[model samples]
Target: MSNRWCAVVRCFVVGPIGNKFAPLGDPGRQSYEDSLQVFEEVIQAACQQVGIDPVRADQIAVAGEITEQVFRHLFEDDVVIADVSGGNPNVMYELGLRHATGKLTIQIGEFGQLPFDVNTVRTIQFSRSPRGLIDARNQLERALQAGLLDGQDVLTATRIFQESGEGKAEIDLPLPEPSIEVDGSDDEPGFLDNMIEIENQLALMTDNADGVASSIEVIGAVTESVGAELERAAQSGASNSARLALISKYASEISEPVEMLEKSSADFASNMTSINDGVLSVLGVIQNGDPSELPEGWDGFLDQLIGMAESSREGMEGLNTFGTAAEGLGSLSRQLRGPGRKINNSVGNMRKAIAKIDAWERAARSIKHKAANNPVG
Candidate 1:
C-alpha cells in the first residue's frame, strides 16, 4: 500500500493470446486461448492493485513494426509481467530478452506446462477456474508490491554469468613443454614423431583439465547462492509454483558454467584417447627395438612419458567429481538434457582413459625394467 512500491510509470505484459497466435485448427487452441484470457484478467487486476497501468503488445494500436515495438517495451518497461504458459517459442524469446536487462520481471505460467528452461524460475501459476484466477491475482499483487517496494531487481541469467566470470577471464591453462629436449638423432625418426605428438596432445588435454577445474568452482558458487535463495523462498511459505520458479531461475543461471564443464570434460576425454594411442605406439617401438640402439635421451623421454600419463590420469579422476555434481543437479530436474547426458558421457570416457593410462604406465615400467637389466648389452 506504500506509494513507493506504486511508483512505477510503465508496465508491460507479454504472453500468448487466445488462438490469435496459435495455429488454426489446433486441438489445444481453445485451451490456450482461454488460459490467455484468464491470465490477462488476473494481470490487469494485479497491476491495478499496485496502482500501475499495464500494456500488452497487442493493445498498443501502433502502425509500425510490432516486433520492434515489443522489443522496446521489453527493454524499457519499469515492470514486466510475462506469462510463459504453453512454452511458446516467441514468449520464451521475449522472456529471455527481458531477463537480460536484470530488471523487474514477473513470470507467470500454467502449472505443469512451463518449459524446462524456465520451469523453476519463481512464477505465479494459475488455472482457468474462477478460484484459480483469484489466487493468481492475489499472488501477482503481492509480488508486485514486494518487487517494487524492495527496489531489488530479479537475479537474471546475464547477471549470473557476469558474476561467474564467464567472459571476463580466459580459462585456458598454460601449455606444458617436455622438461628435457630430445636430440634429432637419425636412429629414431618414428619414435620422435610419436613422442612429439603425445606432448602436443597432452598440452591440449591439460588445458581441458584446467577448464573443468575452473568450471567446478563456478558451479559451486552458483549452487551455494541458489541454495540460499531456495531457503528464503521456502521460509516465505509460498506456493509450490513460487518455490519452483526460484529453483528454475537459479537452474538457468547455473547453466552456462555447467555447459562449460561439459565441453571441457568432453575435450579432455577426446584428447586422452589420442594421447593414449600415441603412447602405446611409442611403447611398441621401444619394446621391439634394442635398448642399446635407442635414440639419445630415450631414458629421459620415458620418464616424461610416464609422468605425462600419470598426470593425465590424475586430472581425469579429479574431473569425475564434477561429472558427479552435474549428474546430481540434472537428476533434480530430470530435464537438463544437455549437461546431464554430455557430462555423464565425458565421465565414462575419462574412466576408460584412466584404465588405458594405467595399462600404458605398466608397459612403460616394464620397458624400463628391461633397459635396467640389459644396461651392459
Candidate 2:
C-alpha cells in the first residue's frame, strides 16, 4: 500500500482568547475546555480512520489577534477542522471566507451553537458525551477525505475563478424565451396558439438549463488554469513551503462556495428533467387536438419553470460568492508562493492583478443580477 502523508489539520476555535472565558464562569470555562479536549480526541479518531498519525499532524489555535496568521497557516495545511461551538463572529467570518476559497474544510459544532446561515451546509454535531465526540470525529474525517480527493474537480474550478479575478457569478436567473408564430394553414382555433406557447415554454427551459451548464463549464476552465499557475509557482521555487501553506489556506477558504454551487447545479438539472417530462406530456395532449386533456394545474407548470429559473439564479449567486473568495485566495496564494525576499518587489504587480480580478467580478455580478431580476412568464 502507498504511504499516506500526514494531513495538516487546522482547528479554528471561535471564542475569546486565553484567560477571558467570562461568558462561561470558571466552572463552565473548565467544562468548555474539557469539551474542547474532547473535540481534539474526536479529531484524533478521524485521523486514525484515514490512516494518518494524529501525533504527526499540526494543530494550531485560532485566537483573535492571529486571524491573518490563521489564514496564512490555513493555506499551508492539508485540511481544516473548524469548531463553531461558541457564538463567535470572527470564527463565522473566517469560516465564510474559507468556504469562498473552495478548500477542504469540515465544520463541527456543538449541538446548539451552529449559526442559522450555515445550517444548510453539512456539519458534524456532537454532544458532550465521549461517544458523541468519537462519532463526530469519524464522520468529519470521512467528509474531509471525500472532499479532498473526490472533490478535486470542484476545488480546481473555484481556484480558476480566483486566478481569473472573476468574483462569484450569480446562478439564479430566468432564461430568455423564444417567440413562435402560428401558421394560418392550421384548421383549429387556439391550436396554433397552444403550439406556439408550448414551444416558447420549452425554449425557455432549455435556455435556462444551458446557461447553468455554461457557467459550470467556465468554472471548470478557470480551475484548470489556476492549477497550471500553481505548477509554475512550484517549479520556479519562488515560494517556500510556508508561503505554499498560505496559498493552500486561501484555496480552502474559497472551496466551500464552489462545492455548494456544484450541488445546486445537480439539483437544478434533476428538477429540470422532471419539468421537461411534464411539458412534453402537455405538448402531446395539445398536438392530439385534446386541449381539455391539459391538466387543471397547467398554470402551475409556469410556476415550476419560474422556480427553476430562480434556482438557477441562486446557483449563480453562489458561484459569484465563490469567485470573490477565489480572487482573494488566488492573489494571496500567489504572493505566498512567490520568493520571500521578492514579496515586496511584487506588491505593486499583485495589487494590479487583484484590481483586474475585481473588475471581472463586478461585470459578472452585474450580468447575473440583471438575469436574476428579469420577469418570468
Candidate 3:
C-alpha cells in the first residue's frame, strides 16, 4: 500500500517462451519471439503499474545455483505471476511450487490454451492483439493490486489442501524440542514438566489471540472511518485523484494493524498446534492405559487439561469476535474493491485459525472426558 513496501516488493514471472499453438480459431501458432513480446507488453507492464519489479526465469542473470535461486524466488518472493498459456512442463512445475507456498500468485493464459487442471484457477486471458493485450494488462494490474494488498486473497494449492478437510492442516513452523527427554530414566520428567510447557505455550497463544482481536478492533474502527470519508468525498463530487488519495491514506493507516493480525494469527495457530500435539500425545497415553497407570501428577494433569480447554475456548471466542469484525470491514468497503478484497482475504485466514483452535479445544476436552470416565481399577 505504501511506496516503501512497493519499493521492495519482489516478483517473479514464469511462463513458456518456446513456440506453441495459439487458440483454436485465432492463429495456428505463436512464435517464441511473440511470447516475449506479450510478456513485455502485457505482464511486465502490469507488474510495473503495481510497483512490482518482475524478473522472468529466463531473464535471471545470476550465476550461483541458478536452480536454487529460481526455487528460492518462487518460494519466498512476495508475488509470482505464472503464465500457463502453453502448459509448458517447466512453467507448470514452477507454478506448482509457488502454489504450495500459498503466497500471492496471479495466473494468466490464452483463452483456449489453458490446461484442463489449471483452467479451474482464475486466470487472466490475453491474445496478441493490441486491444487484447490492453485488457489483459488492466486485469493483471487489478489482480496484482488486490493480491499485493492482501495475499490471503489468492487460493493457492496450499490453501486448497488446508481447507479440503481431508486432514488437519498444519502450517510449517520450527517446533521446539520435546519437553521430556527420551532417555528412559525413572527420574525423567513426566506430566508436570510437559504440562508446564503446555501451559507456557497456551499463555503465548492466548496473548497472540488477544493481540489479534485488539488489532482487528482497531482495523474495524479505522475502516469505518475511512469508508465514511470516501463516501463523503464522493457525495461532494471529489476528483478521482482525491478519492484515490483517501484510499491510499486508508491503506497506510490500516497496514500496520493488518500486518499485526496476520502475524499474531499465524503465531496463535502455530502455538495452538504445538500444544495440541502435546495434549493429543498425552490423551493417547491416557486412553490406552488404565487410569491407575497415569503417573504421579494424574489429578493435576486432568486439572491442567481442563484449564487449557477453558483458555482455548476463550481464545476462540476472541478470534470469532475478530473474524466477525473483519467480515464486517469487508462488507463495509465492498464498494471500494481493493480494500474489500484485502479484508475478505484476511477473514479467510482468521477462519483457518479459528478452526485450528477449535480442534485443539476439542482434543483437550476429550482428554478430560476420557480421564473422567476411565476410572482407575
lDDT of 2 by residue, 64-138 (tens): 234444654344345566766664576676666666556666777879877786676677888877788778877
Q: lDDT of each structure?
A: 0.69, 0.48, 0.66
Candidate 1, overall lDDT?
0.69
Most accurate candidate by TM-score = 1
Ranked by TM-score, the better of candidates 1 and 3 is 1
lDDT of 1 by residue, 222-287 (tens): 778988988887898878787677768766776787778777877876777756555666677676
The candidate that achieves the highest lDDT relative to the unseen native structure: 1
Is candidate 1 or 2 superior in TM-score? 1
Alpha carbon lDDT at 123, candidate 2? 73
**lDDT digits (tens) for residues 104-218 of candidate 3:** 8889988778998788788898876889999999999888877767765645567676577422222222323344432346876565566677767767866886787677688
- Which segments of candidate 1 are over 4 A away from where they belong? 1-189, 235-239, 334-337, 370-377
RMSD versus native structure for model 1: 24.9
Least accurate 10 contiguous residues by lDDT in model 3: 166-175
What is the Å distance of residue 76 in model 3 from its true position?
Answer: 41
Assess the local accuracy of residue 230 in candidate 3 as a C-alpha lDDT between 0 and 100: 93
Better of 1 and 2 by lDDT: 1
Give the backbone clash total of model 1: 9
